[model samples]
Each structure stands twice: as structure tokens, then as C-alpha cells.
Target: MFSIVGGHPALDLANTVAPRPPGAVEEEYLPDPEALVRWARLAGVIEADEPAEPSAAALADVLALRALIDPVLAGQQLDVLLRRWAAAIERSRLIPGPHGSATLHLGTDPALVIGDRLANALIDLVRNADLSRLRTCPLADGGCGWLFLDRSRNNSRRWCSMDDCGTHAKSRRLTERRRSRR
Candidate 1:
């Protein structure tokens, strides 16, 4: 199962590996090409009619892209991110959308489609989004290092999800306060 907590598809891809505290084993949701296709569909990177089978190499590339983008999301690796973005752009095409707007059409190879879309989305975020609004769930605060765009009115969001990491952190704080009183 996948959690679509990240507002952007690229962030969601980065989050495919669940956040774990230090010394905890990482949980990877996309373990194979089939899992990647399923995730791409859930993330809206691939259409219902699009080809679903991806070559093994494409799956590796998608995994590699996920690795490359996660660091960039955390405010590191800009030059490397740019190179990957350029590569994605080179493989993509411009296509017409519903309201006469053009959309980037990442081709049919399932993993490549997801990879290219994620790359484009990351660049779009970099170019248009307020980088200050970007944040990582704090591992010490019961977060799993997932990245998210803080779209709150005051941009005060801290956890990946109010229902998940936020709840955990809040509960921990309450428990700590109770223990301190005892």
C-alpha cells in the first residue's frame, strides 16, 4: 500500500520509502517493476490506458531518480538534480491538454513515464514553488524524514501528515509531560 501524503508527485515518489528512525531498517514500497507501475498509477503518473510493463532497467532508473531527487528536496544536490531534470526533459514531449494548455507527455515505458514526470515535477517545484515552504519530517519528532510542501496559510506545517507523524509527535509530547509530573 502507498500513502499519497506528499502534495507533489515527486515528493510522493521520494516518500515511497517510508521514513524510519536512525538504526531502523528502511521500508521500500517499490521493490520491483510491477510495484513501480502500480505506484505510478496511484500517483497519477501513468494513465489507465498507458502501458504498464516496464523493463528492469527502467525500474532501476526510477529508483535511481527517486534517490537523486530526495536529497534535492532537502536543499542539497541542485547541480545533480538539474542534470537529471534535463535528461527527463530530453525524453519528454509537449502535448495539448483540455483547456488548450500544453502538458509534458512522458512516454509509455511505465517506469520512464513515472521517472520523467517526477523529474519535471521536481523542476517545476524548484522554479515556481517557494523553496522556503519545503520541509522534511523531523526524525526526532516522530517523523520519518518524508518531504512535503508546507502549503499552510502561515507555512507552519512540520510533519508529513497530521494524521500520521504529527499525531505521533503530539502523543509523545503528552506522554512526556505526564511522565515529568509523576
Candidate 2:
């Protein structure tokens, strides 16, 4: 299942690979080209009628792109990711839309179309999103393994959701505390 809590489609994609407990295999929601398309559709990045299947090369590119996104979200250097994103964006062309404003149009390549959409979302997030609100879920239960925009007034959100990671973490801590007292 895809985690859609990033508030941005790109961030959601970056979250596909989640942290795992020690000795546990890492969970990759986008394990292959078909999985990528399924996630893209689930995220509403592509329409149901549109093709979402990615080619092998495109799948590799998408995985590489996701790898670059992680560090950028963590406030790291942007050169590599920027260059990759630039190439993806280059695959698309901006043209006048029926509404009079420019619209990005992608070629028939399914993978290119998906990459372009994710690349645009990432660029927009970097340019317009509140960096201060970006946060990682801190639970040892691997949490939700997703990044989220903490729109809370205090910006103190620690888990992806109170019903999920938050509940798991609280229960874990309580269990730990009880064991310590015994």
C-alpha cells in the first residue's frame, strides 16, 4: 500500500521505501514497473484511463529519482537531484493550454510521463513548501516510514498519523515502561 501523507505526490513517492527494524528487510512498495504504475494511479498522479506501466529503464530512472529525493528532503545538497530532475523535466514540453495558460505536455512514453509529473511536484515542493514543516516519523516500530508536512500550529507533529504510528509508538512505550517496572 502507498502512503499518501506527504501532502505532496513527490514526497509520497519518496516514502515508498520505509525504514525497517534491525535484521528486517526493507519494504519497497514500488518493487517493479507494475507496482510503480499502481502507486502512480493510487496517488492520482495519472488518470485511470492513462497508462502507468513503466519500462525497465524508466523504472530504474524512477527509483534513482526517488533516491535523490530523500536527501533533498533531509536538507542535503541538491546538485545531483537537480540535474536528474532537470532531465526528467526536459522530457516534457510547455505549451499553451485551452485555458490560455501554459501546460506541461508529456510524450506517449508511460515512464516519461510519470517521471515528469513527479519531477514537477518535487520542484514545486522545494520552491513553495514550508521547509520548517517537513518531518520524519520517529517511532521505533518503523513508524510510517514517510515524511509529512506538519501543518500543526506548533509544528510538533512527530508521527504520520495519530491512529497509526502514534498509536503504535505510544503502545510500545507503555509496554516498555511496564516491563521496566516489573
Candidate 3:
């Protein structure tokens, strides 16, 4: 199952591929076409009414885009990803929403629809997000290298969820301390 805690779709998408400790291959959630559609749905990129099937080409495109996203979140070069994202933005159009604001819509093609929404999220990240607050979950538990935005007022949020990784880490630290005293 997918964990949708990244606060932003772009961050969530980047987290589909997680970091592993040394000597381990990175964990990948979007392994095949079906998994890709599942993640898109979970990320709210594809709606229930939308076509979410994935093809060979679409899966390749999604993985490639994720590759570009990972380094950007890590504070690396943006030129390559930016250019690709700009082209994707061109393929979408902003129209009046049912509400007073505007919403972006892509073409009817499923691949373009998914890719464009992802591109829009990435573009929004570059333009609107505070890079300082975007960071990996700080749990020392090696398996979960997920990224999230520290939307806290102090920008000090560390774990993906205090109920999950935070509790595990705290319990682990407590056990270690007790053992050392023994």
C-alpha cells in the first residue's frame, strides 16, 4: 500500500522511490504500470473519473520524471528537470474552476494527463515551495527514507509521522539507554 503523507504531490511522487542503507537497492513503489496508476490515484493526480491505465511508454516516462525529481528535492541541479517541466506545462491549460479560482487540465491522453499533472506539481515546487522546509524524514530507522515538507511553524518536523517512525525511534532509544545502565 502507498503512504500519502508527503504534503505535496511532487514530494509524494519523489518518495515513491525510497532511499536504502548501504548495500541495499532503493525501494521502488511504482514498479509496473498498475502500480503507477495506483500511486497516481493515491497522489490525487488522477481522479476516479479519469483514465488511469498505464502503458509501457507511460511507465517509462513516469520513472524518468521521478529520476529528475529526486535530485531537485535533494538540492541539486534544476536546469534539466526545469526544461522538461516547462514543456509539460505548455501541454496543459489553466481554465476556470467550478469555484472562483483556476485549475489546470491536460489533454485526454492518459499518459499526458498523468505526466502533465506531475510536471505541474514539480513546477509549483520550484516556484512556490520553500526549499528549506522540504526534507527527508529524519527517522534513523534505515528503511524509511521518505521526504516531506516541514509545514510546522518552526520548520522543525522530523519524522514522517510521530505516531509511526517517531514512536519507534523513541522506544528504540529508551531500550538502548536502559540496556546501557544494566
Candidate 4:
């Protein structure tokens, strides 16, 4: 999700319209907390303890979004975002806008840069997107972390040729189990 949403354009979008942080907070690096909350939806994870002091309304808005993305947040109303970061194996051939604004895709070569967000957007166009359209994959050359493609079967490709998440999750559990047994 970080690899997907942290692109320049998304960062710009988050920065462009997001509200300002209050007090002695550093404003340069992080944008408004609300925008950050929305962007987190792309990958369906959000962080906690932003530098800003958001209004009760802002906090509520962020919570609403969190509930939409993650059912777990239904109760916690997250104060901090925590997620497992798996090593990226393959990348997508995804592309962002033709607009050359302050987005991450701005400097990327027109021939390059494609991924899941585009897939989500494209799938959004069909009115009723089949859940299959949401599937994202990755390349083999250690290029992208995840990718998405346009296909009718959507079975067009596997999400991860290397199965990074599965392998990592298994490894993590194995280590934990070994320690527990010991």
C-alpha cells in the first residue's frame, strides 16, 4: 500500500487540499491528516498520532473512512496506523494521469509507471466492477511490489508471482511458533 499510494501524484493530492495542522507542527513534510486518511484507503491501512491536532469533526471523518476500509476499525477508531510491510517482489505496468502536475507520476517516463490505483479507477468505470477487476499483480524482475491489469477474466495474472505476503507470513508464524515451543 505504501508503494502504491506513496507515489508523487497521490502525495500531491493528499498535500494539495488537506487541511493544515495546528500549533508548532512541522508542515512541510506531511500534509493534512484528512487527506492522509483518505489516501490510506487506497491500500486500506491508516497510521496513528499525526502531528496535527484535528478537530473533532476531522477525527470523525477519518474514523468513518477507516471503518469503510477496514472492518476492524469499527471498534478501535484507530489512533495509530499499523500494517505489515512485506518486501515487494514484482511491479505493475500501471500509469497515472496525462496531467503533468505535482504528482509522483509527473517525472516518471510516460512509458513507465502503472499499478493498482489505475486498475481500481478503470474498474470503477464499468459501473458495477466485478471484484476480480480489483486483483493486482507484480513483475518478475524485482521491479514492482504489486500491479493491476485490465482483463475480462481478471484471472489475466497472479497477484504475486513470488507470493511475498504468504511466504513472509508463514516465516513470521514459523519463527513465532518455534520460539513458543522452545
Number of the top-ranking candidate, with lDDT as the measure: 1
Q: Which candidate has the highest TM-score of all?
A: 2
Per-residue error at 27 for model 1, in Å? 1.4
lDDT at position 86, candidate 3 = 76
For each candidate in turn, the TM-score is: 0.81, 0.82, 0.82, 0.24
Worst 10 residues of 1 by lDDT: 17-26
lDDT of 1 by residue, 45-148 (tens): 77877876667876887877777774675678888778877877787788888889997666634446767777778788778877678788898767888878
lDDT tens digits, residues 40-64, model 3? 9878988977886688787887777
lDDT tens readout by residue for model 2, 12-100: 87777766222244688888888888888888878989976577876787777777676776667588767766776667778887777
Q: What is the lDDT, from 0 to 100, of the residue 12 in candidate 4?
A: 25
Weakest 10 consecutive residues, lDDT, candidate 3? 17-26
RMSD of each: 3.1, 2.9, 3.1, 16.3
Model 4 CA lDDT for position 173: 69
lDDT agreement with native, every candidate = 0.77, 0.75, 0.75, 0.32
What TM-score, to 2 decimals, does candidate 2 have?
Answer: 0.82
Query: With candidate 4 superimposed using the best TM-score fit, by how many Å does residue 77's alpha carbon deviate from the native?
Result: 17
Candidate 3, 143: how far from true, in Å? 7.0
- Please provide, for model 4 over 86-167, each residue's C-alpha lDDT reduced to its tens digit, 9 standing for 90 to 100: 1011222335556753332211211111212322222232335343343333323222333333343535544332354335
The number of clashing residue pairs in model 3 is 0
